[model samples]
Target: MTPPTGTPRPAQAAEAPARGSRLRKATALGLAAGLAATGIALSTEMTAGAAAQGSLPAGTQLYKDPNSQVVRWVAAHPGDSRQPIIARRIASQPQAVWFSNYSPSTVTNDVKAVTTAAAAGGQVPVLAVYEIPNRDCGGASAGGAPDLASYDAWVRNFAAGLGSGQSIVILEPDSIALTTCLSAQQQSDRFASLSRAGAAIHAAAPHAKVYMDGGHSAWNSAPEQASRLRTAGILTSADGLFTNVSNFNTTANEVNFAKNVLAALGNPGNLHAVVDTSRNGNGPAGGGAWCDPSGRAIGAYPTTNTGDPAIDAFLWVKPPGEADGCAGPAGTFLPDVAYALASAGASDPTTPPPTTAPPTTTPPTTAPPTTAPPTTAPPTTAPPTTAPPTGAACSVSYKIASAWSGGFTTDVTVRNTGSAAVNGWSLKWAFPGDQQITSAWNAKTTQSGANVTATDLGYNAAVPVGGSTGFGFQGTGSNTASPTAFTLNGTVCTVS
Candidate 1:
């Protein structure tokens, strides 16, 4: 299904054609949830016993694939300018190795090679099994097993490689969530295969943890997703669900969305969630441009250290710098994007290096725009308006995602710190130096004088108490200083 925002879902591209193909040619295969309200907590009562069944055991050392695309690229270009940061930040991190090709003859051995190495090191390896029939709904990352029966057999071979040690499986991303092109019978058959796929894996590798897709928060509603998971046999088949696979939603929103989904599923004791923290540090590009829109950074490092019990781990399911099929062929690792993500995401507090995988998530290092004169400068900064005493207050974060000569782009996040949910919002801010907004997204935004006003679009109107919504814009002129003040629905907000 199309996301609520009608944005394109990020593509988890198919893996490389073979395991060692990248070492010779330096290529690899690669691959959102959201929260609704602010401070929404999962019902501990519902997930009380999940701790015992959720996540790989604490202190589990996640396996870092030595042959990942970044690793090979780093080795191949040791003296390149971007090599140092890419090696230190991304190549060293532990990311899932996708077995996306339908190579039945060698599939078992390929899976075994990875799991066995992890077992030798007493670490748990992550495997993304993406060969579902009609995967990606025939989109850019399309082509999987030709039929469901073939998929089931391939899955069994995949399970054979899991050894006796603990392993994690991100089973068939976009399989359950992106079924719009399938007929009812096609969906049923696919779901049945998924159910059997889980069973076959567990039967072969009892120590493996298999997670199905939960879609992201910006996509399906909790109840709707829960119903889909149920029909897919999530309750009895899989260990948990995964979110933000290749998307760029914030970690906070994914956590909130996962909890709500679990709550709707009646909080099964064995069901938890893992989120993809590969490229979401700066959140979405806004306006649903998921096809490798520029200016994204990496998110939280992969780890099981998430303090919340309902969340199993924050994983690097999508390899950083791998094109989302837009910037390059889906799985090719581009150094420019890799370097961009590393340099930019390095300073982010939410994105730390992983204990086992060095560190992958980094804050964007792109400088905010430098101050410059506008073509049509305004006379003066607008005076602040009186805030209505509706118990609605907010905090705003204004960030310059990228900048260039005479133009720049920004993302503005508005968080509700009020007692009540904001049904709708209008945010107003005055430019310190007449920075003119040429275009805007995710809201009806316009500028008059040095003042800019942005109101919510219908789908994203509500900002639940403690929840946030964001919008972005492309603008002309540059300004180092953020707007001195911001008013949300006429109530002044805490600016940062």
Candidate 2:
């Protein structure tokens, strides 16, 4: 999702992959759910070498040896504590998913929410701790615990939230790197609290993988950053290190720096590094504002395929498209930035980078076209539209996915509250006002002034026996409808 108009948070990618000719606009809705949107899954088990996502160049196999075996097994099966909170999993070198947001007070509930979805398989979800003391390190995205004592209590809750499920805890972001702004005693106190936080989480979820931030390769020297982690109990209690939590750094550079930090910390085996690939194609612009920073594209999403054994998955800890309140209010949704980031990931996940990850759900952008092209002679058989599914839980949902002037892209979500998925669907709407489609991309967007009908073609013609398909269009007019109706084949779901 794009950063809200003018905010500090990054702009997560959330749209469709590159179309041969027409690029279907994507809404930045799935950003909080980090896992790259599309890619081939790891199908083979490794003996001494491994193959990961395209984000990491092929031939760069993680050793299938002892240590890697454990990691590989963990990588092969991504466990989502809560699938609903985390909607999609991006299979990059280091496979990772982000949990959808939940209240800080209910930290454990959120953790359970994600792990429940994970079921098993050892899939690691990215978890962020914002209830820290002096969060944001007093920068653009600043919002932390009211005080150190409160923060310590919050950390304890956060640790308990793990709930036995495996997770990659991205400890209080910018907590250490940006601590200079604090007073001497305040810094020390915060560090001590951070140590306790790590201890608490490790105690609760031994299966979890906790990594302390290493800033970005560009921000701190390996030796310097490693020293901080070491002091923060990284070597003793935490798994290892994490880099680029909320910044831009290429896979190679981040890996290189992470390795250096590990070597410096002198705990390579115990310490593994992960990179944040929410928005880093172009890397840092000259100035570097951090939130929705421009010239950025898409970096690798959280994955476990780091070329080096010390590196972990490239997870998206930051919710893409959600503004980093700094630029505006810190946590508002922005559509344009969301579209840009989602589109970038669909095309280039290793470009502009960010630190975001959300829930898990199936992403079929790169799947075989569900609809047939228009070249065939079936005049009635128009191409399947690029409408996304929705309302699977709700009785009805209207998805106004994307837009560009005259026409806007759309989709629908239908809840199969009934015993079965609606097999056939037809969308009908009358013109309470004047709206017409000037041009259409993924749908056979046809209209009779206010009367608009959109239907899927080809394989999508019939929704799964228990599933639903969305019909979309690119139309023009004031989006005002006194009565917009929908019919699944012949059954009416929405009436005016």
Q: Which candidate ranks first by lDDT, i.e. highest? A: 1
Off by over 4 Å in 2: 1-105, 120-122, 326-328, 345-496
For 340-373, candidate 2 gives per-residue lDDT tens digits of: 3443453534423223454344323221221111
Query: TM-score per candidate, in order?
Result: 0.63, 0.51
Determine which window of 10 residues in candidate 2 has minimal summed lDDT.
15-24
Against the true structure, candidate 2 reaches a TM-score of 0.51
- Candidate 2 at residue 256, lDDT? 84
Model 1, position 255: C-alpha lDDT score: 96
Give the alpha carbon lDDT tens digit for every residue of 1-496 in model 1.
1110101111223323111011011111111122111112223321231222555676667898887778878889865656777777787788888777668887888888888899888778988887777776665566778888888888888888787789999887777767667776676677767877877777677778989878787777778677777766677678899988888889999999999999999999889999988878888764565655555788888888889889989998878877554334566666766766776574533345434443343322222111111101122233233454478778999988666677666788888998877766789888987588754544556688888888764445567788887766667775645787998877889986
